[model samples]
Structure formats: structure tokens, C-alpha cells
Target: MLVLSLAIWAVKAQGGTFNYTQPDIDSGKALQDLSRIAKENALKRLSSSSSGCTADNVYFLLFHRVYIWIFEEKLRTTSMGGNGEKVNGSQGMLPGGTGGGCIKEGPFSNYTVNLGPLTARDPLAHNPRCLKRNLNTEICRASASLKNTTEVMLESPNIELFQANLQGDFRYPESRKWGFSVHGGGHFIIAGDPGSDFYFSDVAGTLTMMNRPPSRNGTLDDVLDLEPLGEAYTLGEMLDTVGGSPFCFVYE
Candidate 1:
């Protein structure tokens, strides 16, 4: 809750006027408006860009993400044991989250999350709790359709446009358009408490390394520093996902 609140606060701090109160979400044109903003702004940027490329290696990631969350897990015959980083998860203090609450049985049944819900009470305090879940199919079908994913992958030419489209930035909207972020759709695949919360968002890719604009052009020398997790790498080193040190698997 604390962390999520801070995120919302940050959005407001940036002069972004979004309907943060989560209006009767079932009936709101604002979200629809946001969809248009992301599409137009992204398309405009792509057209004006000079270094845009349509190479296959540029942006091929599509429904593979959905497959990972849904099918990949199903393919795992063994139980997901405690082998990765451990943390205690918590709820967003929602008034009885629809669908369900803390997971009772499963690999994460014994799992606990700490240091989250970053709020005014204790920004980084170690508040441990169980994980909560709420799968939402409505959002997945409406916003994260194949059409949106295709647009985001093929329509966007520059990194900025891709970023905007992938985020569905509604901070600036005009009329209407049919579009939404595949990234946002993935997040909503498990929407309810923490799932819907704006805790974190990130991505990767090869042709996506270049940040081209009128002012400057991004180069492979640029550094990607994921401090606290691992050493940084140059933009060039991250090009290959299968034949590299940091990564060793190819998308099937």
C-alpha cells in the first residue's frame, strides 16, 4: 500500500491528471481516452523519427509473454521450490478484494513478502505479509488483445513511441483510438490487489536499445545499470538473448 501510494503520488507530482480515484471503472471514457493518447502520440513520434527500423530482431516479442505466465507455468512438472530471491508480499488494504485474497495453497503458500506498500507511515519499513491474488479476464481481453500487441510491436518505430504505446500513456488524450499497452494488459491478467497496484514495470529487447530522437542518438556504449541485482552492461552486449553470458535461452 505504501509503495503503491507513493507511485500514485509520483504520477500526480509529474503534473499528470489521471482519474486516480479508480472511478466506476466498469463505465468510464477516460480510460478509453487514454488509449487514444498513447496511440496518437506514439504514431506521431514514429513518423517524425529518422532512425526507425523495421528489422525482425527489433521487436518480435508478442504473445510469448502471455504464454510464459499461463502455459509455461503449466508445463513445469516439478514444484516451484525456494530457489530465487525471497520476499514477503502484502495486500493493498483493499475493502475485501474481489475474486479472492491471500493465496492459501500452492508454491507461495509459505512465502512471505517484506519491505513494500511504501507509504507515509514507513517508507521502507520491513512489513512482512502474505501474497494476495485476483485474476481478471475482462481487462486481459479488452485492453491486451492481439491487435494492440501487433500495433505496439510493428507500428512503433522509435523507442520513445514504443514506450508510450506500451505504457498506454493517457496523460495526454484527444479524441478516440483503438489501442492499449500489451504490458498493461499482462499486468491486469492478474488484477485485484497487488496485481492492479502500480508497484513496478519494466522490459527488454535488442533493436530497442537505440533511443533515437531529433536531439541525440543512443549508442551501444550506453550502460544499463540494474544496481542491487547485478553488474551493468552496455547496450550492445544485451543484443543477443541466446548466445550471451547474461542470458542463455532463446524464445520458443
Candidate 2:
């Protein structure tokens, strides 16, 4: 019976997909304590970093993903007395406006975040402030659909077509026609406030307005170089020209 129970627990721990959800605001006082603990752990990890937290780093996504993963792990263990069962997905209520107003509840409600000074030499220099959020439901609400879109992207038959779709024309409502715009929207919605590291900066925002010509040149490399293209190419290269300039790439 003990071995059977352990087997089931291990499967449950390792098999489930992380379903992203809003932070649970009504978790009460216990959540407050958990928030503090998570924040401290995150801060300690951040302080240990030479880069601190900034968009300049190419590995920003990876860094934060791991950071938050650790934070969530600690939060789960501490809150549930080390049961090791994965906690529910991230929690938070969606706000109604374009501006994602402040977060009022949940595990992170009581904890303060140190954003560090904008001009500080080290991006992680300790500058403490209340953790703020500008919750935009419009974009966040689209997260559900975005998840589905990602699944479709993964199953796409023509890799080149998939890449082209992601590099769709950079326009407003038009830009959203492609997956890239939606990707940026998710970030903006999550980090609606300026102080947040994920805040939608001008660099990414303005790139949406630039016109991108289709690949008139013959090769995938040429397409990436924005050269005129003659034919559609395949996924020979793993590079993602998703937003145009200020590109980021990651390999597993």
C-alpha cells in the first residue's frame, strides 16, 4: 500500500501540465505569509544574480521562468507543509481596463518587490517598493485562446508557413492577426505597469508598426535577413524573427 501510494503521488507530481490561471485572491491570511516567503526567496535569488532583472538580458524569459518556478515551489512546500503536491496555477482576477490596475489580494499581496533604480549600474541594486500590477483583462483573458493557438502552432504541417504566420505584418488590429502580436500582448497585460520587469517597453511596442516584407529571396537565411524572397522556406533555421529587431532565441 505504501509503494502504491508513492507511485501514484510521483505520477501526479510529474505528469500534469501546468494550467496557467489567475492568482487566487481569496486565499486569506495564510496566503499573505506564503507571499512573503516566496518574495524573499525570489529576492535572494535575484540578489545573487550579477545581471539583476532587466530586459537587456537575452535569457530574461528563461531567468524569470526559473525564478518564478522556484518561488512557486517554495510557496507550495511552505503553504502545504511540504506535501510536494504541485499548487494550483498562478492566480489573479482580471481587471476591466487597458491599464491593469494594482493587485489587491493573493499570496503576493503583502510582499514588497525591489525593482531597483532605473539608472543604477546594477539592475538588481536593492530599491524596495510595493509589488504593483496593472491587470488588463482584455489581453489576459485571451490567454485561454492563446494556449489553443500554441497547440495549433506545434501541430502545424508547414514549418515555413508557420514561421511566416508568426512574422505577420506589424500593424495594430492587423498585427494581432499573427501569433507574435498576441505573444507581446500577453506580456503587456501581465506587466502592465512601467515598474515591472515585464512591462511593455517602447522597443517592442513600436516594432509592431514597421512593415515586414515577405521572403522574396530563396533561402531561409535570406528571409531572416529580410531579403526579398522568391519561395517559402522550411524550418531549417531555428531563429525566430517574431518581432523583428531586438530578437531573442533559446535552444533546449
Candidate 3:
């Protein structure tokens, strides 16, 4: 068993701020520590939060970002021997695999995700189980480069254009316009099947509602005026952006 410092498992930090940073995959121990902390916090939040932590209530990007931010802070504090200083890094994406198969590596390998089966009438009431992932390199891979992300952002000056580009048809890979399509690709790649939170359904619709800025006129200009699009971001920065946005409070 990996022997971790007692401070690593200390109570979650409250109202503290830290510089955004990515997860260090270079250290398997650090990766494992981060994943373990993430899983624990995920479960705790699911059990205690007002929304019960279901996909239906907690928006995917916002909730997961908050989850990851919490994980990042804990990991940083532990790795630095509990100094509690600002850390720099982002969440590590799951490495690519050959074909569709269970996720067998990373800190989340053995971790159990307690709140899921989005189909369950009351998913939170279900028992905890090992986190499940179906990685598919064929359809989704690390090939999504920063260039592509930048290009998409550049093309999508406003929310309407961004949404239109993102809702591309999946039949032809090349036809996946941008934004949402790429977003879906990441989800499919990371969570390939029915078990994934990204699995298409009403849950995705909920996420869309959660992500979109409220609009009265329902025009791109209005929405952009409300929340302007910015540069591409790492997973950590993305989470921070979403968590700090007005959308975070919109969920309740």
C-alpha cells in the first residue's frame, strides 16, 4: 500500500485560494493521490451537497471543475508537505488506449464513484461502485491539438455560433464542426459507453441548460455581452473559469 502523509487526508480547505495548475502525471504517486482525493471529495459532495450531486442537478463542466479544483488543492498541499502555497498545473486527461475498453490506469483506476447511473430515478441512492470508463482512441484521441481548440474559439465569436458549431453530426468525423462536437468527443473518448456521465440523454440537455447564459432575446450578441468568450484553457483553468462564472450560481 502507498504510505501517504497524514496531512494528505486532512479536512478540505475552506475559502482558500490557489494559483491554477495542472496535475503532474510524471509522478504516478501524485496522480494516484490526486485521483484518490478527487474520488473521496466527489463522494462526500454527492452525499452532502444540496443538489445531491446528480447529473440532473450539478452541471457537468461547473461541478466537475469544482471537483477538480478541490482535488488540485489537496494534491498540491500534500505534495508540498502541507505548505499550502499556490500551485501551478491542471487536471491530467486520461491517456489514450488502443480500442474501446475499461480504463485500467491512472489514480482513478480502483476508485469508486458513488453517484451515477444517471438513469436511476434516484442515482444518489444507489450504492458506490468502481469508477467506470470506456476509452476509444479510434473515435477520440489526444490528437485534439491546441491549434484546433484555438481555431474553434476564433471561429466562434459569440454563443450562438459556438453552440451551432458544437452540435455537429457525429456520423462523419470531419463534419463535427467545433465546440460542442469536440466537447462531446472528449466525453466519448473518456467515457465511451452507457456508464459515462457524458452518455447522451436528458443529462446532456441538463448540462446544456447549465452552461448556456440565460437569454431574454435569445441572441448571440446578448449572451456574449453577458459572458464574453475568451482564449482556450487547460482543464484546470477551464474549471476555474466555470466555477468563478455567474453560471456556477445559476445551477441552484
What is the TM-score ranking, best to worst? 1, 3, 2
Query: What's the lDDT for candidate 1?
Result: 0.46
Model 1, 30-90: lDDT tens per residue?
Answer: 4444433433343444443332322211222322332343444454664532222222345
Worst 10 residues of 3 by lDDT: 219-228
- The Cα local distance difference test for each model comes to 0.46, 0.38, 0.40
- What does candidate 3's lDDT look like per residue over 110-149, in tens digits? 5555544545675434467654554455445333445544
- Leading candidate by TM-score: 1
Give the per-residue lDDT of model 2 (tens digit) for 11-47: 3344422222234333433333333333334345445
Ranking by lDDT: 1, 3, 2
**Alpha-carbon runs more than 4 Å astray in model 3:** 1-99, 103-132, 137-143, 169-176, 196-252
In model 3, the Cα lDDT at residue 14 comes to 22
Off by over 4 Å in 1: 1-99, 113-129, 171-180, 195-218, 223-233, 241-252
- TM-score, structure 1 vs. true: 0.44
